[model samples]
Structure formats: structure tokens, C-alpha cells
Target: MTPVTSRVEYSPIKRARVYMKHEMGIPERRIALEEGISPGSVSGIIRRYPIQKDATSCARSGRPPKLSDRDKRAILRLIKKDPYITTHNLIVAAGLDVSKRTLLRWLKHEGIVHKPAF
Candidate 1:
């Protein structure tokens, strides 16, 4: 016996395509302007509709960092001088002992990759 197979679908993009091609009559800018979506999004739907097997997660967007240049510089200096420094050392130097995870997050936010000293 063979197992059943099913096709993946994305209703929203499909609807967007229909609106672009038929309901809106292939006017990408008009469709986007009237429907309040990006023109790029309209083009993407028309291009990727048939080839895409499933709905892919859109790339995330976000604001810039909260930390200042001074803060990042301080963190980088500390990491470079003693890459083996523990979270406790970081807390002691930076005056924030939130946790190892929080410390790591800040470090990553500053683009400081950890390299064990030992």
C-alpha cells in the first residue's frame, strides 16, 4: 500500500496573486496601492506562486540597537584583553550581573564572538 500525499498551500499569497492577476487585472502597483501592500510583495507573489512548494516565513525586520557606541567599545575592549573572562568578570567590569544568557546576548549584540582563553 502507498501512503497518501498532500500538497502544501498558502491561501493569503494565493489570494494576493488572484487580486493582482484577475481582480486587479495584473496591475502590481495599483493592486499594492489599493490593497495597501508593497509593490515588491505583489511582484514576489506573481513570480513565486507556482514554483514555491509552501509558505515560507518572511524575513524578520527590526529596529537598530539600544546600546550606544561607547558601550559596545567598552565590551569589545574587555573581550579582546581577556577572552577567557567569565560572566562574573564581565558583571564586575560592566556592573551588570543579570545572567550568563543576558551577558551573552549583550556580547552578541555588540558582535563580540567569545573565544575561550584556555
Candidate 2:
């Protein structure tokens, strides 16, 4: 009995063929038929070819920071001065424009986990 393998690896030749098809203005379906690969694979290969060739991947964009470095430093100093300060008190003391939820998120990101009293 022969063993079954689940992994499928495409060779450089297949990648080159996809690029060549795109260069020759061939449609994705036709390229898939000729290359014996799925149309989605052909489309993905063409789309990612430039990035792969340049060795540069796309950068991910997330929500911008509400507090700047200086503000964060001030908050840290405030926390250090009074270790038991509540989130609401910290926001008022630091004069931060952010909400208590935002402050808690920032504190959590800074590795300061606060558990509520039972």
C-alpha cells in the first residue's frame, strides 16, 4: 500500500509560468488551465509576485495611539509616585484626554494587570 501525502508544494517553474502568463496578458482562467493549478492560486501568485520579487511584504495598519510617548512617560511617573492609584484617579492626575477604558488598555499593554478586590 502506498502512503498518502497531504502537503502540496509548487515549484519555481510554476511561479515563473504564472508571471509569464501575466506578462503576456493571459486571463487567469486560461493560466490556471495551462498551469494545472486553481484559478485562485493563479490570481494569488500574480498579485503577490511583485512583493515577493522585491522581498518586501505589506505593512499592517492598526489604530493609532491616543497617548504620545511623553504622555505615557508622565503616566508612568504618576503610577510610580502612587502605586495604588485607581484608573480614574490616574487619568485625572495625568490630565489625560483619554477615557478610563483607554487608560486600562494602556496599563494592560504595559504589563500592569490589576485584579478587582473580592
Query: Who wins the lDDT comparison?
Result: 2
* lDDT per residue (tens digit) for residues 1-118 in model 1: 1225562334765545544464446577876676566777666666765554454434435655455567557667877898888777876786553567766787775577766678
Candidate 2: C-alpha lDDT = 0.80
Assess each prediction's global lDDT (C-alpha) against the native: 0.62, 0.80
Give lDDT tens digits, candidate 2, residues 46-68. Answer: 88877775423344466677998
- TM-score of candidate 1 to 2 decimals: 0.35
Top TM-score: which candidate number? 2
| Each candidate's clash count | 0, 0
Q: State the displacement of the C-alpha of residue 71, model 2, in Å, after optimal TM-score superposition.
A: 1.1
Candidate 2 TM-score, true structure as reference: 0.46
